[model samples]
Target: MTSAQPSGEIFELQADPEVVDKAALEGQLPGSPLSMHRVAKGHFRVVVSGLRTDAMLRYRFRVHRKDLGRWIQVSDPFAWQLDASRQRWSTRAIGLEDATRKKARPLPRRPTFDQLVIYELCPREVVPKATRYADLVTAPTGAQPRFGSIFRAITRRIRSGYYDQLGVTALELMPILAQGWRRATPQGVGRPFESPTERPPWGYQAMSWYAVNGDYGTAAELVELIDAAHARGLAVLADVSLEHGYGGKENGLVTDLWPRWRVPRPKNRWGLLELDLAAPGAFPFVVGGLRRLLVDLGFDGLRLDWTEKVPPKTWKRVVAEVRRFAPEAILISENPTLPLITEAGFDGTWDFFFHWEAPLLLRRVYRNWDGLAKRLVSTQRKLVENLEGRAYPPHGAKRVAGIDPAKGPPVVRYLESHDLPRVARRRVRWQHGGGHLMDVDGDGKTPDWLNHGSQATSRLGATLLATLPGAILLFQGQEHGADDELIWAHDPLESRRDAKTFGHYQRLLKLRARLPVLRQNDLRVLLSDDKRHVLAYSRGEDPARGDDDRIVVVLNFAPQAVRRLRIPMPSPGRWRDLLGGKTYPCGKELTLHLPLAGSLLLQKLGKRQTLGKRQTLGKRQTLGKRQTRAKTKDCEPARYARHASKPVSTSR
Candidate 1:
């Protein structure tokens, strides 16, 4: 079978002879109906005598079904464009490259996965309610008002230079595939009902893999937005769903065209039909669509949704094929528990370890602070060990054979995502609720719940995220401490912007991008003060190189200030506080006052100053005298504890 060229008159599609008996193509113009001849078991082709290459040619395929004893109309599964209202295939038939290749300008340099600080946003939430157009007056009365599309809003953001200013290297957009044409209900038993609207169900219930969501914009508009991003030196990643499609057993594709293409949904969850990867001609179809997205649509990477639900072998095969075509593409899985991402040939996986445990640390749930710190360290170590194919004793899992560890950590640490409730609510119901909301103070009723303490905890979380050894992701509005509960098809933080919180994240992210030590995968615990609720650690690369590039992070988890707290110094000399822009002298330790949930990020200064013998002696005497007095003030009772004892050191 011959396929259409960049400007050809012939069109081709793939179908199994075992599934389809005969096929015909239909177009909108005169002399519409065209016959398709089967040249091979899985190849079907048709020729148009005088077809235009510039204008969109709306068309569909009519297939003869043996089981139903009737003909059925189906859209081309490989169509680059879709007529949303009609649910038909619409394309210029000018080859997929004409969409993005001519429009997307060259980027200065594409960032690697390790260098990427990803920002994930849902397209649905980005569309503005109403935008005023200067020239065209669409509304009858007042100023010209037009409802903006998702792509337009995002293009405006890119032109405004928000992402560049925010220091994010890549934009990870949520699924943009055709969705929201129908709803899945228990009564319908996987039957689809018409429910088209501006806002869809987060684009997870995808209708077509090859078509752009109509609500967002046309395929051309989407390409322009991506080109705008590339012009600004930013990479774009597409979040895709491969586990299942939107419709069920009653769907036309499942019942008529390709019955063997689907498998039973596991436990009938979500009433969605799963794709049978083992089916004949399935891999080529899936891989072709993915290639179109990456190569033709100009996407730099993919974030596969719900990857753990996909069979391990199927996932491996998909990764291998995608790598064969797009070797530099970044592939990250949504599976957080598994550390063998490199074994499956994935760049990274979601860091559920940090997502699950970091909040507990912020809440100060564990009384034994040192023990909790050790557990956190141990958990991170186990992740490394598992990636290196070492035996894990806690889970009784042996060494995974034939796995090679990558140079960088295979995790993407994030504090908030679309899957979980906001951080404020999570902290309020700190005890139980399975990361969901309960009847609590943080349920939007208590404004005080989002006060000073909450912001401090968020800043603390951001500090840990920046200093951690992996790629990082910040969900929409997360950089500014958005605390609204994640409701389906709703985004509360879209209209809210806190300059202070935004500035905080901007400073940290920019620092992380510039500092070599922050990007490296080396950490050493320097101090853990259980009584004062403080933890200090040093992060750097190559210890033998000394303290030039070493960074020290000291965190105070207490709700109240800790006065005259002395933290041990890794090296004795002068040190500079990168965050506060202050310099201090150190012998064996340094003393400072820490605010509520405050942190100090310090780096050793190369220039050292020596003090005279008498001056050093006098300083030591004064510090010793003040240490006794400071102890009484620091020995306050723990707020969350009853009958607390005097503060004491329990560092390891």
Candidate 2:
């Protein structure tokens, strides 16, 4: 162990008395323990070979302070595991050999970067209250304790086809590592942690990097969850906080190992200590933890939390080490620092700007279509620039990509996330506050569309989200349009689910899965009109291919239907509405009537694939003139010939 201190001090390794006796009884070690030798000033080393790997062993260091009065006992900062049965931390062996020797499970086949539909859920919140780890209460007999396990709950959901029905390709779990707050029973659930006076239900304040949070489950149970998710064809991405370590009384590594390198002033509410990335031994320690999470735990990927606070070089190194250990594992950042972080092998980052801008534009809260169009164009341009390796400016720059179509969208799009206010809450507020209630008939009464738990609003937003070119992220309960604001302490188990909203999200997700163009990056804005509050876009291969599979999306932000709106067509003869199954014929332009807060997905139809009357017209045209004349002369007029001669109606 290396430590920085003043000169002339002795360091000693102290194995637990019981562990030494157990090792002796098992004939795994010699009776005498090794003495520490000073390798450098304030740095010491002890070569203890032939230690038992099969048993749990505890150890600490006896080192003299700079004052050199009394030797202090401290746990190893780099200990792979910590014994949490006691009040104070003690180093534990954790059967490293067995853990490493267990047959490594192969990761499940992951979705392509563009095809990912991420469902971010806190495992602790999804299960019933009585089953949650933090909500476990003593039995009526007061002898036994019962609680919920994330493993079992997630396994149940997977078996129930909840995620499958939602078309979720990936599951992004909140942190499951050892966190700061203690697990409280149902009787003590409302009680707060002493230092913070409030516990964050989301496990962001990591106390131990190596140990799995016992409250969540054992390490083996966590592996079970990963394996089950994989079996269900879902990639699991863990949220890890590498930016800082927990502080206050829960400061585990910062207080024990790298006290000198801890930066003052908490970076967030958890009272976390920022680590100095440049400091000696810091990078390796962080990388070691990452290896433990990825290599040891078998996760498919990691979502690095609050990456902006970390030095770019440090992050690059961490990502490199992660890739080295698990080459196929995906690396994503919560913040969109693309090209910057992407250069370090990051697949994508969260599109916070899209999360913000989409709501404003779609809600008609900000009705400047020109400004919205400019922003969209600018964002798309920068995303392309980033994908092509062009340099851009620093933090909060406009050059960052939002939701756009590309081979791999640099940013992941979401209407709601843990970091943002719930979309349902916003919808509820807008509906109650007289924000153009989308009453199509203008009856001056609250419409059914407004009463179905914001189903219509959610459908509109979800349509925009699913159709956009990017990896999509859905927050927990977002599928059901959950209205509860996700505060740090709020329990997810209590959140209400709306069946109508859930069905809408499921349909949108299934649509996204079925449509290949929605996953591609090729996009062209066909029209964006401010006065009409309408935006139209097309996604497909290069416009040069007339027969390439193309989907035209029209979104109406206004509260009234826009009739006979002429939208430019890409050589459209017949177009089928993929969602509504209605077909419309077009020449150079197509006249459309879009309902308020409604969206239309139109796919160009091939001549041979035209349906209903359009197919009859095609057949009549293909017939020879002799056959047509023979039939027409006998019958006066052919039914298909008359149908072909009439102009195709544009009514929906």
Candidate 3:
């Protein structure tokens, strides 16, 4: 094969000569067939004139397999758009002129990294079933259930202020890129089913990095959805799986042609074919795909999936190149106990520690409540320290060349995610023993204790999550008490108890936005009571300064109400409960009555006012009847005995 600069439209295909004997470009140019010459070993190229650079170009490539001995049509590995029905490729090869004509727009205005509240949703799942099948009979084969209308529906809702009301600043879209549809056996071999089955709801099994999922929607529709979100002041983040690709029958680009791109032994836990980043041209291929998603299409950021599988050196290079061009783009990692935060220069990573350990504390399963309290306080301090770059440099602090002192890291905090079970559906297995406590009930089994007060427990978790420092995430339907598990075949947007749970989240988010101290990095543990199952923390720029901006959050995790609970305050002032709209005067210590599974958001009052008669705070709404009695025998002082010599507050 030889190389040359062509004057007109050029098409190229890189393949193994042993696999492909011949190739041709089948386009609309009215030619019988445009034969492609072998420009290099295992490489073919064709150039044609009379093609309009401004118009959308549609074409397909046909290759004659050496084994099959007949020409067959296959998709281009680098196609921007694929006509799933015809199995064709589309592009406008205007070259440099195209870039000049369509200048990339600046990213939409978004809140600071610390203030981000991300709402994750799958595009196909958000739309109703009836809507997806409306045009099924009239549409061509494999073209029914088009998601373009769903994109428009979401865009309409965004324009209608739905997201603003929900108080989320960003939308994290699940994978929409072309994905593998082939089923895999228990032995991890991709196979074709004799009969068709419903496609998976999630898009984790990626087929083409560049092509938009035709089943999901057209590229134009996706662009419109993102643009509309931006207009509504909502940043859009794309979740990309760079660790592995679909190794099914559909991935002919790698299987039949570029087999060298696949690793000798797949390393991904998902049993998919992992990409060999060390191979020739692999780095540029991945980088080009990233540029397409972030530069050509305007995505505010990316939530990289399975970041642990990728090498830190490769991630560092990828992140450096992306940051060089898109400086404001936020890159998040998805490794549980991520060790690459600073090395890869990601803005944030999933807080798996919170996801795994928070339930243990909430369930009160520990024998020593003091140990649990200490663990909770220390975990929170570690998170804060990581974000502030005190213990480790923040995500973006380490670039390709050296440390970048200007960039600070954010944290990704959530109770429910795509990987986690919903709070209502979660069954607490022995976090230590790995055995869930189950009870038989009329031929059906249910988890004991966890079923009781799930709603209240959910609210408690949300309260603690929202007040902590991080980019908080609320999975789809999680804010509205959707108890069903994530079904790959079917996902409904609405739930039975939407009003109550939705209202709680709406109010909680609005309160977080209204309070400036909640968005800051400073945190101090004010109370961690073991006996009463109560905890309190203060958030502010400086709680020791005793300013009016200081905010204290008190939580009661007990199954029953606790009376005369006292928590020390930073200063002598009148504090108001923002959630319940109650006020109390405090000198150094504040005493209060809290309901079962209750929480309080207290903000210091600048001036003194007459306090109303003390009333018991409202009890949080619960779901089940099962309750666990707390052990109140072991009594402790207001502060930990180990910290008796220190001040009342523990600021890390």
Candidate 4:
């Protein structure tokens, strides 16, 4: 194994052509997957693409050390011995340093930087049909969400300055595996297979888990995408729905090949395609296929959707087998109910506590503040205990290294996801209450669902999601104020331009990624929730990093205002609003100029992993001439004089 050079830089991996040439002549390394290209006389480069990176900034490098007969894993993504003229290699922001001795090293598991923010976007849910590339919904026009067409589009996003641009470190994609899709039409879209007049592009109703959907791109395309992501410094995770499958729809597959495959055709409309993990051959076919797919493709982690539904015992075996294929694979289970799953083998379970349950409780329509707090307490206690396994602890919970009280797998927290009513839909549903689905008014203007429900909550939710500890998963457009509920319908691409939620989301993403405390798992408990009027909590290592240290978070959820906001902390310093760089008073109590209770982002005032890389940002492209002029006024003075201000004092 080889170590990457320096921390926080991007290094690439190239096949040693000299060695490859020798091997090619003698037949050691395979030609189909591995290739070498020439550089200068003395050195050759083999660029390995499709590696995942995080804010920690690590590169995956492979090398062959003569000392060790077998090939060795290198520290950096790209490596070369005695390449003195390599300026590019020396100037990257990677933490993994190059070896001076030119000896092979093993790749390490820990990230150089501790904070990693993985954004989740069910592509079809976020990007609307008929949405043109330019019709980005923001009135002022902001940055576009880094979305991809091919699997590589994701890599391009990681490298293209999207996540990097947005300040997000790692990236997570909803199932890229085979999801049957069709053009939105009146009949319906995807597996339900409706007329063009009846479809929506939401991919929840999937078809096959083994094959990568053609619309999203091919398997090779996916590989290229992952490799590109790694180069861009992103740690990638594949979200797999191990709980159920698309079995039993008009669902037709070659079951005989996988004799255990069960496609049940239930009588009910909402009937799911469930698998009996207890069944024979069923476990392997279910587990093996995905395990093989992930290892073959090489992803950084796995997000198991709804592991709660899967029997715990069965899930244990599945996880054990998955580790055999890729041990460094981060296991994240999206089970809202089973906080205990963290001990079963999962690195963490989705803290639906923060994502939905807690929020819903804060909303007051569902659960009360006490109810929410109790739920948190109940689950947290159960999770705190380590269930002894035959080998190690039962996958209940294990405190992470370097993070005290950070004992649980990360809680995947979110505001708006592919499921549920759009943020706006929820609001509208609460207030005026109308559509089962959003409908254009007779005047042709879109419904106010986005502005009221989806739009408002989205902005607020983003702020809160970023402030919460554990992990924050960004759904597409939530930052930009997505107005549409992620409901699937069969129609032409009509809704794309209507939703203008990308800019806010992009801002939110960068904020969340910059804060390390929000990424740490500890008790970010919400206090003083009188009938869900205000949502508040504390996150991070509180007693202090060496001793359970953390930052306190308090929110005034009342849509009106909160002149005084009180949060619990051992003591306080000036609390800074990480969102707009605003600072709030600290001590026993703090006051907040509350806009609404839906959401926000806050960090304790102190030195931490700073936000996005500091750069003289280029002029942000404005949408209209008026906005452009405003931007010019804002950016020109800084841009021109800074470059022009250099004095010609060369007389010395």
Best by lDDT: 3
* Regions of model 3 farther than 4 Å from truth: 1-10, 16-21, 26-34, 47-59, 64-73, 83-105, 133-148, 189-201, 336-338, 360-409, 426-450, 488-491, 608-652
Which runs of model 2 end up more than 4 angstroms from their true locations?
1-104, 134-148, 182-201, 266-270, 367-409, 426-453, 488-494, 610-652
The residue-by-residue lDDT of candidate 4 on 1-652, one tens digit each, is: 1234333212223333333221101011123234334455323344333322321111222344333454432222111110111010111212223122222112233242235566676543333344222111211111211212444444444566666566565566777654332332223223443332243333433444454443454344466666666666666777776645444322222231232345444331333455556654566656755664566566677787667666667777877888887776777777644434534677666554344333343243332222322332322222112111111122334543322343433455565555544454445432111132322122323442322343555556556566654556665544445455444531112343333345655666655555555555455454555543665566655444632234555555454655444444443344455555554433344444455553435555444422112212335633232332112211212112112223112100
Question: Per-residue alpha-carbon lDDT of model 3 for 1-652, expressed as tens digits?
Answer: 1112466766788776776868887655447368988878778888877764455455657788886777776667776554433232433334423321343345467677777899998877766554342121223322222323556666776788878788988999999787655654324755443221255536777777777765555566677777778878888899998857776644334545655677777754456767888877677777777887787777889999888888888899989999877888888888743347657888888765556445545544333122312322333333333434343342333533332332234568787777755675545322211122323121233443443426777777778778877678988877776666555444445544567677878888988888867877667778777666777888886655656788898988676888878788776556778877766555557776788778898888774342222211112322123321112211112222111233133111
> Candidate 2 at residue 546, lDDT?
59
Give the top-scoring candidate (TM-score): 1
TM-score of each model, paired residue for residue: 0.79, 0.72, 0.77, 0.56
Candidate 2 lDDT over 389-445, as tens digits, reads 232232233444532323334668887776655565643332211122332222445
Please state the error at residue 507 of candidate 3 in Å: 2.0
Candidate 3: global Cα-lDDT? 0.63
| Backbone clash tally (model 1) | 0
lDDT of 1 by residue, 549-597 (tens): 7788888766678777777766655556788775554555666777877
- Report the lDDT of model 3 for residue 111: 71
Whose lDDT is higher: candidate 1's or candidate 3's? 3
